[model samples]
Target chain A: MTQSGYASERETTEGRVFTVTGGDWDTVTGSVDPLSNEKIVVNMGPQHPSTHGVLRLVLELEGETVQEVRPVVGYLHTGIEKNLEYRNWTQGTTFVTRADYLAPLFNEAGYCLAVEKLLGITDDITERANTIRVLFMELNRISSHLVWLATTGMELGAISMMLYGFREREYILDIFEETTGLRMNHAYFRPGGVAQDIPDSAIKKIRDFLVYLPKKLKEYEDMLSGQVIWQERTQGVAILDVTGCLAMGVTGPVLRSAGLAWDLRKTMPYCGYENYEFDVPTATTADVWGRYQVRLAEIRESLKIVEQALDRLRPGPIFISDKKIAWPAQLAVGLDGMGNSLEHVAKIMGQSMESLIHHFKLVTEGFRVPPGQVYVSIEHPRGELGVHAVSDGGTHPYRVHMRDPSFVNLQAIPAMAEGALLADVIAGGASLDPVMGGCDR
Target chain B: MTIEPNESSTGGVPVSADPVGADVNAPAQVPSSPRKGMFGITGTGDVSGFGGLVRRHPEIVGTAKPYGGYFDEVTDALEEAYPGFADAIEKVVVDRGELTLHIKPERVLEVAQIMRDDEALRFELCSSVSGVDYLNSDARRLHVIYHLTSMTYRRRVRLEAAIPAGGSLPSVTSVYPTADWQERETYDMFGVVFTGHPNLTRVLMPDDWEGFPQRKDYPLGGVPVEYKGAEIPPPDQRRVYQ
Candidate 1:
């Protein structure tokens, strides 16, 4: 067999050789001859910077033009959804928030809304709680978009923009830390309402951000929007038209960039979105430039929403009034910076037996959702973040399927890259802004 | 819809308006019934003979059904547009209060395309595509579920198509482009082929992988615990990674 021209054969001490052959390789390689037109298979990354976290793209290229691009995900699949089934409903928020790390609030909000609708208490969310959710979500949107801008900028060779983008994003993270005690995976939004009230320090920080961010946005626009290199690299590259977008089930900024204003926020109005006044930004040009312009405009619109939510933030109860659903004690930071409000523990353990028992039962058993299913869609930074939550009359979810926009949007990559230049593949992929954590989860 | 009165805090501070309802046990109906005829229901399963009780407030009855969860009025509107809708719908299940329609697998793509293009049933957004293996349940074990939303109506609907193991079904990637990755994922994990998927290649797993890992029947492999100072054999003697 080795003499028959299989290059990979190994010879034994007895002078016999065996050829290992299977998996269409003989046909794929095209000939028994070693010097034939051998197709090259290149693994782009489980470590490449362009892959956006442990994503490996196996590209089959015939000299620069890609014949096939196979995305190898699940390198970051943490099994968070499966883990949610074992925990209580309230505790599940902590897990889902980590799925799409860039847009943590969106994950929490989607999970909470699904549970709230299951409990038939969607309408009971207070204006204050709703306002706070809107505030954090938009702020998180800006932060997520900033990460996109930073990474996309770096990928396109605008090194300075990357630094500036992250620098500004750090400010938003600061606000999140002050409010929720952590920058990322802030599981602040509970099933019925938010975990706690926003503090004065966080309010001041957000107010400062609202005033400061617009000027920074202009600076970012001036740096990249008109730069001939940036324009040439992005404009008219990776064109996924409305038909293609809809067919591929792509949503968020990418879909909007294709000229459809299908924003779930404007369309569905979850968390009292209809009451707020903000435009759903869109672009007519279905290209990389269009995606860039749409996301930039979206940051501005999210700022507008954040401003409105802040102004409407009157003092009120942050959690649901129903004791069964609400956390028995309020969460507050201690010296160790973990939640340990002494007053709350004292009330539950020392002062009131009912409080202690309620806390015990709620923490252990969790709340039961009627055996039914509901799909809740919210506008996340990337696009329509829909949670299809099914409960089988149990304390945990029967099936929790997330319509992750990043995952759906990434399908357009092959369509966008097949005929385009190799360099444009980076721009096209970067513009899509896929987070593999979200994609694989 | 009378607003609850505000109460004063212990320190003489006025408590904020309790926008969340105070009563956890508010008299709302809950869906509690398991679906009947696990497979194959004969001709429109219309209990409409229940008349005004179901028609005037269908959601109430829908919510009250055993295993009944919260029922949305939007699905009710869709029921009106597609005549014989109840017959076409195999099961109306509320899982965590999310509405799921277990439609026959052959009609999955057609119904999805209609939901996207139809003026009233504009489920313009196909949010997620996933597959569930119900090996513990019926013989037709694979359920390809689609979560769709209408941006115009601010409504949502679940479209489900079930196929027996080793069955091939029509692909919806042609109708909703986003279905491509999802269908590919389903094929990768469940071994349920999407007949006409342009690039139905392995997504998460390598193309060379032998079995679908997500199927309930697929064995979850584990390694034997090695003893302290145990002799380990080379590659040829060791079992291959699954």
Candidate 2:
């Protein structure tokens, strides 16, 4: 039996080697042999039009295919981890929320979960608070995925997707601003609980958004999925199997797309995710297209989760009941912005001296955590976002390190990009969703 | 932390905020005094109860046998599987329902390989590799901690190894390839070298940047922020709770 085609196959020590141009197009390209060809090294942006966000790629290429890829990261380092050592436990949320600027709530939730575990108050978090956390986290996941879709679409020359993606994301940001007083780095998920309760207006907005987004998603699918160029650019491109995903520590949708439903929310079940009823969407393609499909499907799954969370939203205290650990002042919407309710402020400042002192004591010298360490991980939009926090029985953290999903999942780039076409590198990198803010933090 | 319930001075009482006392889980560490001034306050501003404050780290002590939950199964599996389990395993401290195995620095690579490939231990995912600097309080100041996740069993375990200043540990990147960048990040932040890393240059900091910034003794240098009326010093410079 002989195997002969446009690209002829010959047996060699390395196994069956394909002579790509040897059969039909011999004279046109002179029997092109990749092994003998001189490789050209191409540097693609710490600042490129594709906008992987300060990511620089060094590629060794033979013709149009990438022979090897070396990714140069840390261009956006902000020292969030080192700076966290100087702040108190509660104040730590503000610093960490900025680590992965896109998925801010996940960072806060993961940090708070670790801190709560260290404080021995993991089980003590209020019901309403847990619901709110889950609600906001799922919402943030949608927004982050939208940005991924938008930016990735822009990079792949799907200009309409870029516009539609950002346009849909604005709705979620509006809700965030209404609830947390900011869009991106809302440090709303405090250690004990959320910073404040979700207002009726935000709730109404979310309810409206839940209904509005599904139709918009369908339109997006109709637009993006129906396009042959989008499919051609993604399908079977940047392929990575389940083993490659695992060995390189890739998780979240990239792993999920590789046909493993290894979601921390399902497997580990922190933040009372066990109580929620939602399916983990997955695809078996293990390519850029699979990741895109998985992400879009995930947004739908998240919308379902968000709807359930809203239905289950009971009116109880948002923060923990323990006054020693929870925020002292009542958070309210002032003319300037979110602040202590005017009546509570008046009572603290003028009406009661003892109240003022207690607030000052708790606020200034944050409640001391017991001397111990704990690592808490949550499924972020990218992957397993873990926070390894250590305390020295002091108000401030002894050490805290975020094993960010972007940071870990970015490791799979070389595994995915090498040997693929030069264009597929961008598709593969985008599918991994490496937000440099998270990667370099 | 209930390794020996009877040996505990508090007598079945849980590990509390009472930092000065002896607990069963926390063996007596090298005594380090509290900050002399109050909450980063300099000058002889005497007696604000900060003098009496003793902020102690949770000491690393071996928990007694039949360690509860999946911890027992993990240790027993490692014991049966690896010949040098005792020699390699320093201490197993189970705190907050999580298992932490303190391993010898040299044996980290072998143990990591075993932990990954063994059917009984299948911690295939190297979830995180980071370093912590417990400066002034401990003699071996720099400690590298690895968080491993077993997807098959949905279990998580921590491996901690302490090394002195300028000390190096065998790289586990051979066993778990995910540790490549993380080990580099640790090297970048704490200057704890991973001996067999393929390319061990700094990952986060600039190439020419000097000093390990995450070390506790390393000065956090910064200029103060000023408003129209008042000036607020940088976090490292200002008075804060010690």
TM-score of chain B of 1: 0.60
Which 10-residue span in candidate 2 chain B carries the lowest summed lDDT?
A: B1-10
Residue runs of model 1 more than 4 Å from their true location after superposition: A1-40, B1-88, B91-100, B113-124, B132-142, B150-155, B163-168, B187-202, B205-242
lDDT of 1: 0.74
| DockQ for each numbered candidate | 0.26, 0.56
Instruction: Judge candidate 2 at residue B159 and give its lDDT.
Output: 97
lDDT of 2 by residue, B1-242 (tens): 01111212221111332322133332222124433333655466556666555444456778887779999999999999999998999999999999999999999999999999899999989999999987666678789999999999889999999988778899999998999999989988877888898988878877755456676644343311124644333454455555
Q: Summarize candidate 2's per-residue lDDT along A311-332 as a digit string, tens digits.
A: 9999998888898898898887
Candidate 1 lDDT tens digits, A183-226: 88888899989987888999999999999999999999999998
Interface RMSD of each: 8.7, 1.3
C-alpha TM-scores of all predictions: 0.77, 0.88
RMSD (CA, Å), candidate 1 to true, equals 15.1
| Candidate 2 docking DockQ | 0.56
Position A19, candidate 2: lDDT? 65
Clashes of each: 30, 0
